[model samples]
Target: MSGADLSRLSLNTATVKHADLRTAVDAAASAGYGAVGLWRDRVQEVGAERAARIVAEAGLRVSSLCRGGFLTAADDAGVEAALDDNRRAIDEAATVGTRELVFVVGGLSGSSPGGPPGAATDRDLVATRSRVADRLAELAPFAEARGVRIALEPLHPVFAADRAVISTLAQALDLAAPFAPGAVGVVVDTYHVWWDPELRAGVARAGREGRLACYQVCDWILPLASDALLSRGHVGDGYVDFAAVTTWVADAGYRGDVEVEIFNETVWDAPVAATVATVAERWERHVAPHLAPSPGAGMRLLDAPGERP
Candidate 1:
C-alpha cells in the first residue's frame, strides 16, 4: 500500500509511551497517521485542554479513548465513582473530538483498591460479570448523550481474575445488547482475543449486529509470562494472523480506523518517534494489506482528502 493508503492506520499512544502526550501526537502525525488512540492518564498528565489543542493542531483524529471502564466493583459507592470518572472521560473525549471511548470492563469487585478485598474468587466470576453488565447499562445513556460510543474491550482470560471480567466478544455483546442501539459496542484487540476459539464467530456477530466500535491491532506471544501485562508483540511478530482477522472484520462490515495498540514494554522503551515510525511501517506492511478495499470488498476506507502523504 502507498503512504496515503497507510494513513488509514492509527497509533494507540501506549505503543510509544516513552514520550509524553504531545510527543506521541507529534510523532503519529509526522508519520502520516490519520488518528490516535489515547489513554486517559496521559491526557491528564498533559492537561486535557492542552492535549486537545495539541491533537487538533497536529490535525490528528482521536480515534478512541483508551479506557473508561473499571466501573464494576463490590459496592454502589465504587460504581458511582467510576460513573463520575467516565462522565469526565466522555467530556475529555468530546473536547478532543473523539467518537469512541474504549472500556476495559474491570475485574471482580474485591480485586483492586476501593474494591472489597478478598471477595473475588473463581466461584464468584459469573456474579462479577453480571455486576459489570448492570454498571454498563447505567453508564450507556450518559455516554450516548455525549455522542461517545462505549467500546467494551474484553481482556485476555489471564486477566479474568484481576483486570477485566468481560473476557470474550460473546460476553461483551451479550452485556451490551440491553442498551439502546449504538450506545454500546466491543473493541476487538488482536492481543486479547487472538486465542479465543470463537474469535471469527464473535467478530462476525459484532459486525453483523453493528456493535463493533473499535478494532485494535496487535500481536500475541507464547511462553506467556505469568506477571507481565505489557509484553504484547508488534504486528506480525507473534502468532496472530492479522490478515485473516482483518478480512473477517471487513467482511462483517466494519470500516473504522485499524488502531495499532501495542502495549509491549520493549516497544515503549524505544524513543517515541522511532516506535511510532516502526509501528506505522509494520501496520502498513502486515495489517493494511488485509484491510485494504478491493473492487468487491464489502467496505472501504473512509476517504481522507487533504491527509498528508
Candidate 2:
C-alpha cells in the first residue's frame, strides 16, 4: 500500500481488553498505531470525557466506537429505550470527536431473552429485522444532526439467532440505503463477512454508494471457542484470506484506518504492549500488501489524532 508504515493501522481496544482505557491508549500509541477502536464499557470505566482527553494526550485517534444497538425489544418502551441509548452513543461519539459510531443491530425479538439463547420462526425474524429498519429511521437523523454517522455492523450469521440479524455486507448496505450515505453507513469487518460469497461485490457497492464507514480486520479462528464470540485471532493467526478480501476493500476506494480487532483469550493474556507490537507486525505482513494505494495520496490531512477521518 504505497510504502505504508504503521501510520495507517488501528488497534481495537478489545484486542487488549485486559487493559483499561488509559493502558490501551498507552499501548496503542507506544506501538505507533494511528488509532484505536473503543467499546462503550471501556469508556464508561473512565468516562467519555476523560477517555477522550487520554486518547488526545496519547496522540491516538478513536477510530470508531464499538457499538450502539440491541434493537430487539418487544415493547414500545424497549424500542424507545434502545433508540435513546443510541442517541447517547452519538453524543459520546461527538464528545470524543469521532464521526463513526458502530452499531451491532440485534437479532429477532426476544430471541436471546433473559440471558439465554432463543430461536424464532421466519415470521419472527422478518418482523424483528423490520423493527431494526424502523429504529434506524429514528436513530439515523439523531446522529446526523450531531455530525455523526451510524455504522451498522452485520455480525456473522452464527449470531443471526441472537446477536445481529444483519448477516452480510449486502444486508447492511440495504439497511443503510434509504438514508444519506453520510448519515447511515456500514462496517466491513473481515471476521464477520469474509466468508460471504458476494463479499467483493458488496464492498464495491458500499463504496459506490458512499456508505463504507469502517474496515475492520481479524482472523476467523477455527475449532471455534466454547463461547464462539471470543474466537477472533490476529490478522494472520487463522484462515481468513487477508490479501484477497482486503484487496477488494482497498480497491473499493476505502482510505480509512484498517483496525486489527482480535478477541482471542490467548492474545489478551499476553503482555498488552507485546500484543500491540505483534498485531502491528502481522498487519504489515498479511494485511498491508493487499491494500491498494491510498485514495488521495498526501492530500488528506490527519485531522483527528492519528486518523484521516
Candidate 3:
C-alpha cells in the first residue's frame, strides 16, 4: 500500500488490550491516528461518559465500539437477558459518541473454554444462527433510535464453534438485509474474511447495499497458537494481500476509518508507544496505498516519541 494518507486510520483498543482507555486514546492521538475503536471493558473503566470526555479531549473520534451481540441463548429468559445487555451496550455506544457497534455473535449452546467443540457436542448450528438473526431483529430498532449501527462481524470458520458463528462476510450481509442500512451493517475484517472464496464479491455486495460499516486489518500468521484466537500478526507480517482487499473496499465506496485490530499476545505485551508506532508504520506501508484518498488526505501527523525515522 502507498500514497494513502493517515487521516483515515484508527487504532482498535483491543490491539493494546493492556492499556486503559485514557492511555490508549492518548497514545493513538500522539501517533497521529484519526480515531480510536473502543472496547466495552475499557470504556467502563472510568464510565462511558467520562471515557467520551477523554477521547474528545484528545481530539480523536470514536470509530466504533468493540461488541454487543451474544444472542444465541436457548431459552426465553436467557434471550431476554442477552437483549437487555445489548440494549445497555447500545446506550454506551451512544454515550461514547460513535455510530458503529461491532457484534461478535456467539457460538454454539454449550461451548466453553477447554471443552469439546460445540459443533461436536451440540450439533445445532442452524438453530444457533437463527437465534442470532432473531435477536438482531429485536435489537435493530433500539440501535437505530440511538443513531448506532449494529455492525455484525463474521469470524473465521475456525471460530464458528466457540467464538462467533457468522463465518463469512456474505453471511453477515445476508443477516443485515432485513434492517435499514443505517440500523444494521457488516464489518469487513481482514483477519476473519480474508480467506473466503466469495470475499471479493461479498465486499462488493456490502458496498452496494451500504452495509460496509467498518473495515479492519490484521495478518493471519501461521503456526497457530494453542488458543488460535491469538494468531493475528501485524500487517505485512503474514500472507494477507492488503493491496487487493483494500482496493476492493475502496472500489466499493467505503471511506470510513480503517482500523488496525490485532489480537496477538506479543503486540499486546509490547510497550504502548512502540505498538502504536509499529501500527502506524505497518499500516502506512501495507494497507494505506490502495485506499481511496480520505478527506484531509494530507493532514499533518505527529511522530510518536520513539517512532523510527
Candidate 4:
C-alpha cells in the first residue's frame, strides 16, 4: 500500500487500542494515512501537550478527539462535573490540534456519570435527551472560544438504553441546530447510522446546514461480540454497503477526513501495521471511488471568522 492514495484516510486510535500514542501515530503516518482520530485515554497516556507533539512530528492531522459528552446526569452535581470534564476535553482537543470533539451524549437517565456502564435507573428518555440539549447549550460557547466544535455522535439504537440517548442523525442535528455550526455539529459514523431509513436525507440536511463535522466508517458485523460495543469491523468485512454510504456522504459535500474506527477484538488483537494496511486496502476498494472528484475542500466552520479550520 506504499503508493496508495490515503490523502483523505484517518486512523482512529481505538482501531489499534493497544498501541501507545507514539506508536499509533507513527504507524498511521507510515501507512500513508493523512490523519488520526484520537481517543482521550491515549491522549492522556502521554499528556495532551506531548501527545500533540507526537502527532505533529509524525505529519498526521488529528481528525477529531474521541468523546467529550455524557451529559445525562440525574443530579446537579453530576451535571456540573460532566460539564467541567467536557470543558477539559475541549481544551485537550484544542491543544491536540483538532477542531472536532466527538460527543457520546449519555444514555437513559441513570447510565454514565452516576451508575454502572449501562444501568439505567430511570427510563425517562425524553428528559434525558432534554438534559443533553441543555448541557450542550452551556458548553457550546466555551467550546467555540477555543476553536473546537462539539461533534455529537448518535449511537445505533441498540445502545440507546445505556450508551446514548441521541440514537439518530436527525436527533443529533436537532440538538446541534441551536448552536453555531462551528461550535456544535454532528458526526456520521457508518456503524451507527447505516441502518437508518432516513440516512440519505439526514446527510443532505447536515450538508445544507453545514453541520457535518466528522465522518467515520466501519462495518456492522454479525454475531455481535458479547460486548456489542466491540462489534465494529473493517470497511468491507460485513453488512455495510460502503459505496452507497460513501456516495451519500460525498454528495453531501463532506470533504473532511474519512476515519476508520473499528472496535472488534480480532482487529485489536492483530498486528497494528497489518490492521492499518487492511483498512487502507478495504477503503481503496470500497470507499475511495465514491468520494467527490474535486469539489471545494474542508468543512466550513462557524461565523467566528478566525477560528474556522
Candidate 5:
C-alpha cells in the first residue's frame, strides 16, 4: 500500500482454503497483504512455531488464530476435550505472536453422548449458552496467564442450531462481560452480524466496553451454496453495507486488525493471488473508507502497536 497507503488487510487462510500455509503466506505477501489469520489445521501442517516463523519471515503478522472454542456439548468428556483443545490453542496463539484467539462458541448440545452437531431436537439453547459462559470463565485465567484473549465470534443466528450458540454481538458481549476485556471479547464480523437489527447498538456497546477484539469484513450473497458456510463473498459482491457497519466499529474506538475472513468455495477455488488481490482492492474500496485516523480523509487503517483486529 505504499502507493496509496491504504490500511493493511489480513487474509484469513480459509479464504484461500485451497493453498497450503506456505503457499498462502507467499500469495498474501505477494499481493501486498500485511497480515494473515491461521486455522489450526494449517498450523499443524507445518507445526505452530514454524508456521509463525513462515509468516514472520514473509514480513507478515498473524492477526488472530482462527479458533479455540466449542464449549457446548452434552457430555462431560466432550466438554473437557474442548477445554483441553482451547488450552492448546492458547499456547499456539502465544507462539504465533497474536494475543487474540477467535472462538466460534458452539451450538446445541447433541442428544448422543458424543457431542454437538448431530440432530438434537430437544436441545436447550439457554442451558448451552449458560455452559458457554461457565467455560469462558474457566478458560479466562489460562488465556490471561499466556497473554492470549478469547475473541468470541457471533455466527449468524441460523448457525445457532449447529454452529455457534453465540449468534449476535450483543450475546457475545454478555458472555464476555464476566471476563476482562483483554481475556474475553467479541469479533465483529460483517458477514454474520450485518443482518442484525441491533447492529448499530451492538457495535456501539462493544466499543464502549472495549470488547471489540477483531473486525472481520465479508459480504452475504443469496442463492445459497450447498454448504451455507461458503455463502460469503468479496466485500462489494454482496448486500452488506460495509460502510455503515465499519463506521460503527471505527467510531467505537476500535484500533485493531480488520481481518478479511471468508468461506466461499468460489473464492477458495480462484487463483490465490487474484483472491488476495480482490481482498485488497475491496478493503480499499468498501472497508477502509469507514476506518482510520479519519474516515473522511480515508487514511490507511493503521495496525501500529495495537491488538490484531
Candidate 6:
C-alpha cells in the first residue's frame, strides 16, 4: 500500500474522558496526533484560559469543539440561554484557535407521556426542526463574526427522539444553506451517519455545496443497545466501514482532519494514555492502510508527528 499521512489524524477529547483538558491536549501531542478536539465542559473545568494555553504550548491544533448544542429547547427562555451558551462556546473556540464549533441541536422539551418526554411525537417533529433552523439562523451571524464556523452535526436517528430532530445530512445541509458560505455547515460523524441510506449522496452534496466543514469517525453496533446514546464503538470494532467512508470523504475533496470522536464507556474507562495510544495504533493499522496507494507503490507514509515516513 502507498504511504498515507497519519498527521491528518486527530484525537477528540471525549475519547479519553479519563483525563482533564490539559492532560488530553498533552496526551494528543505526545501521541503524535496532528490535532486535538476539545469538549466544552472539560474546557470549562480547566478554565478556558488555561486550556487554551496548554493546547498552544503543546503546539496542537484545536480542530473543533465537541459541542454547543441544546439550542432547541421548548421555551423562549431556554432558547435564549442556549444562544448565550453557544456564543460563549464560540468565544472559547476562538480563544483556543479552533475553527469550528460542532452543534448537536437538542431534542424537544419534556418527555413523552409513555416514554422519554423529550422524544418528538409525529405532531412536533416538523415544528422542532423549524425551531432548530431558526435558532441556527439567529446564532450563525455571531459565530461568523467571531470567525467560527457552526458545524451542525446531524445525530443518528436513534438520537432523533431526544437529541436532535435533524437526523440526516440532507436536512442539516438544508438548514445551513441559508447562512453564508462556510458560516454554517454540517459535520459528518460516521457513528451517526454511516447507516444512512443516502450517506454517499449526502456526502456528495455536502462536498458539492462546500458545506462539509467537519468529519468525525467512530463505529456503530448492530443489536443496538437499549440505551443508544453512549454505546458508540471504536474505529474498527463495529459495523462502520471506515475504509469506504474515508474514500468517499477524500474523493469528495475533504482535506480536513479526520477526527476520532468516540464516546464509548469502555474507552472512557481506560487510562487516558492507553486510550490515546490505542486510538493512534488503530488509526495507523486500520484506517491508514486503506488511504494508502495501491499495492507495490513506493511512497513513505507520513508519521503522526508530521514527519514523512
Give the best candidate by lDDT.
4
lDDT of 6 by residue, 122-189 (tens): 44777878888888888888999999999999988877777777899999988988987568878999
The most accurate candidate by TM-score is 4
Candidate 4 lDDT over residue span 1-309, tens digit each: 658789899999999999999889899999899999999999998999999999999998999999899888889998999999999999999999999999998777665432364544778888889999899989999999999999999899988978899999999999998898899999999999999999988987787787889999999999988888999988888899888888888877778999999998899999999998999999899999888633442343233232332
Better of 2 and 3 by lDDT: 3
Task: Show where candidate 3 strays beyond 4 Å.
Answer: 1-4, 117-121, 293-309
Stretches > 4 Å off in candidate 6: 1-5, 112-115, 118-123, 290-309
lDDT of 6 at 177: 84
Mark the regions of model 2 whose C-alpha exceeds 4 Å error after superposition. 1-4, 113-123, 293-309
Candidate 1 lDDT over 207-227, as tens digits, reads 667788889988887666454
- Clashes per candidate, residues 3 or more apart or on different chains: 0, 0, 1, 0, 2, 7
Worst lDDT run of 10 residues, candidate 1, spans 300-309
Q: Estimate TM-scores for all models.
A: 0.90, 0.91, 0.91, 0.92, 0.91, 0.88
Structural RMSD, model 4: 3.8
The window of 10 residues in a row where model 5 has the poorest summed lDDT is 297-306
Evaluation by lDDT, superior candidate among 2 and 5: 2
lDDT of 2 at 170: 96
Residue 253 in model 1: lDDT:
68
TM-score of 5: 0.91
Identify the runs in model 5 with alpha carbons over 4 angstroms from their true place: 111-122, 293-309
lDDT (CA) per prediction: 0.79, 0.84, 0.88, 0.89, 0.83, 0.79
Clashing pairs in 4: none
Question: Regarding TM-score, does 1 or 4 come out ahead?
Answer: 4
Deviation of model 6 at 213, angstroms: 1.3
